[model samples]
Target chain A: MPLYLIGLGLTPDSISLKAINIIKNCSKVFLDAYTSILVSYEEMTKLMTEVLNRNDLIQADRTLVERDAGQILNPAKDSDVAFLVVGDALCATTHSDLYLRAVQEGIQVKVLHNASIINAVAGTGLEIYKFGRTISVPFFEEKWKPVSFITKTIENFQMGMHSLLLMDIKTKELDWKLYMRGIERYQNPRYMSCAVCCQQFVDVLNTDNDADLSVETKQDFEEIRIHAAKAGFSVDSKCVACMRVGTDDQKFIYCSIGEMAKLTEHMGAPLHSLVVLGNIVSDMEQEMLNLWKL
Target chain B: MPLYLIGLGLTPDSISLKAINIIKNCSKVFLDAYTSILVSYEEMTKLMTEVLNRNDLIQADRTLVERDAGQILNPAKDSDVAFLVVGDALCATTHSDLYLRAVQEGIQVKVLHNASIINAVAGTGLEIYKFGRTISVPFFEEKWKPVSFITKTIENFQMGMHSLLLMDIKTKELDWKLYMRGIERYQNPRYMSCAVCCQQFVDVLNTDNDADLSVETKQDFEEIRIHAAKAGFSVDSKCVACMRVGTDDQKFIYCSIGEMAKLTEHMGAPLHSLVVLGNIVSDMEQEMLNLWKL
Candidate 1:
């Protein structure tokens, strides 16, 4: 099997004409749904439908993926397979595993890289190398909650760097009928929302001695800019709220956490992530971030 | 005037067709040259020629961006300005100031996000968020040598995390020619190659106790998987040498730093960066990271 691992970056519109071309040319596809999900699920589906003119492309969720990537590995052993990954083909190492598995199975594997949030955060005006550590703000468990991510964020800011806070995922696509990693009934109905993310952030600061290194106050939240980006690569429903990103309708701005807390109206759908910007007032590229406003 | 910020990830061709369409629509560009540089001088120029069909886009080296941006704010305020930034648009907060300045001048700004090595490192089989304070390795100098970045890397790994070792860029573009920061030029015009990056890692470790953390031995060198991510963005050229990343291009193997140090031939062009993999390998992903033909 000649399997091609293709990536679909941040937003639905983020994919290139080239990727669309490759998808069309592939014989068959096996989309991995575990490592990451597309920014625009429906939009990407629509796009693939339009491009492939077929809807039979296999949507390989975690179970199928974790179990038998061998199908992708030895596709031509029966049929040729084109493995599709969300975001970039290699952004998450799991896709590489699938590729290697295919190679081990003597399946001819190829990779087609696309834009992922790994590089998309550049839009937030933060230096990629300067970013301390990236931590996802997953939906917390009530009692056994883990918010150590806050400590990392504070550390990043103190070092004069920006932090990218990826929100968690919540979907209903699991095959509940199947018996697997005890995950048959493993549907967590909620994804991490910016509201939760901010509330937790403030909670962390309020509990610490971080006045100089904190935005603990509600007033400071007013100065915070929180952007919630959707997951699929074909999504246009991306909601850009928080005044800090721009004057009015600008591409990027620095909004206070308070403003971000009230952005539920702007943040719609799944696959949402946040960018909590700090001290970005010096980039000469700022002249470019806040554009397209009336 | 309006300014647009665009990121070109790590691959030379890692940009989106949408981004290219947007770039072509721009009249002039002011690129920020400090955070990261495009592929090589030749590739960057060629990219411009192929995309915009023009070569007049102003390469705003740090000095030019810092100084000339003022003009972009004032007299040239009426022109549609595009500030092409490397990596993701918001990955570096340094560019936000430029956006604010444009806003102050009543100009508009837009950001076109692209992939960067920040997330691309995930392709190396390391957990995206399991990384610690990111730092750069400068081309070693005779007297002004420094290796503080090593301290941070060690701290992160000690805490069970990874480290992204960025390579430095020494550019001499039109912007550099006109607005020189006059930093010392490299004696050998050498970039911090993988071998040098590893050697430096050894140099830093040697100063302290790396006996347990010691990867000084050639055997240790053989165990490391150094990534040489070349040609970022849409058409990125990636060759995972020490290991076969996702696919097998056996042509890229050996013990040049465990075959991870295939610097000269693999690093498609200049402006490439190397990431030293740490201990926190995602076991699920390691299945692939291990296949890296070491």
Candidate 2:
């Protein structure tokens, strides 16, 4: 009885026959709901009980998976246990800790892979071969904004490699305040949109580097222009705003980085991703980009 | 009426429920066998005819797709047509040419994504976020050897980003010798192995750059060492050799570049990939690599 790590791809029907059969035979099935969610917990429940006709589904939240993994792994020692994940099992937020734990416990482990946005982003007609290191843009809070992803994007641009910026998703997260008060209230889910991501990039580009602090009139517009140029991208740099990729209602918008910031209210839905075009876009790539131009 | 591009993932059963249903209903179904193959034609025919209970399967080779794409797109104007590809529909080979052609002809196109080695390689426990631009290693001929991939791997190494080097596959390749003489024949399929890729990397490291031609004793080992150091990697650098990733028989071997090069005959079957580790590997990544270390 091996512990099966199964990937339920982007769409509900994207699950493979191998995964479905494994789910059916497993003594216990745990769906990792905290890292990401393909659909609502209710919808996934319906998929399992109604479609898969298996009622052994167990919802594993962040605390359950990260802090109390034994609830899922312990049973695998004697019975088949299935840990279901959205997208390819190991692509997005890694379950490596759990996998390592399983290995340490001498549990036979098997992984079933499926499609993930890491691969599905190719549907934008941008060749996967040219993509550089992927970046994750988290929702910026008032005091804790991070611009490392923006800088990395600039580096990718300088190297003539496209950047796939994966927007962050917050689901079933416990509010720190609530947790401190011994109340287990979960916060509303938040999914980062391309608008937010682009605005952050623009913000980073507008700011002067710490090294430039010694310069006189550091806040001057001309000074900022030189710094932005050094950063490798600008408000007018081309970017592709993707919404709900690998779904029927998928939408793509090709526009300047600054222009994308204005699409905050209309891009639609969760799971948005942004692509910063590198300097090496080929004629064919440019043609494909034109199909979604604003 | 629409032209559907469906991905049959790494394995035969990796097909999705949506794809199976779509294939069942499509008036004409085509398996793009030239770009890559998941299983033999006879096995796939059995999968479609016996498993799916449909007999509309058409084998679309390179000439049929690249040369006579109209054969697949024409019927899509009035009836449903499915073009099946091994791995994720767009990840490996860009079907953008065929897709753009469909759009030009005003044919509606729908793509169904599935798992491909692009995302599945994350099973190696190297965070997908740390991967740089992918490089493809082709079968080098005696007179047409290219070392551009080696240079790119070095660039990825310098950037502290892992490089996923995709091994080339030659499926249904035309025997150019026979084709020129009007003998329509395809040579046997060949899939690149990690052993060959590692050996090529070693060969590139052992050679001095063209600029060194002006210097006397350019072939000296000390001169090659200086160039290899400037190139950012050497025989002792770490790499992960992957065989048949995303499948049940998937195997991983983590070893030094020199040791990997020596594995010329034992890495096992087709669809192999190599990952050149970067300088920034985390402790968890190292632990995972230890699990498969040679």
Highest DockQ scorer: 2
On lDDT, the candidate that comes out on top is: 2
Question: Candidate 1 — which residues are off by over 4 angstroms?
Answer: A33-42, A48-58, A68-71, A76-81, A141-144, A151-162, A173-189, A201-271, A275-294, B29-64, B70-81, B90-93, B173-188, B207-272
- TM for every model, in the order presented, reads 0.68, 0.91
Model 1 interface CAPRI class: acceptable
Q: Calculate DockQ per candidate and list them.
A: 0.32, 0.80
Q: Residue B227 CA error for candidate 1 (Å)?
A: 26
Tens digits of per-residue lDDT for model 1 on B1-294? Answer: 467666665444656655676667666655565654444445666777876687875666767666767855654366666666665666644466676667677776676665555665555555676776566777655434465555555555555666666676554424444346765443334455555655555443333334434234433323331211111101011123222222122122223233343345553334444544444556665565555544
Pairs that collide in candidate 2 are: none
Candidate 2 yields a Cα-based lDDT of 0.83
Structural similarity of chain A in candidate 2, as TM-score: 0.87
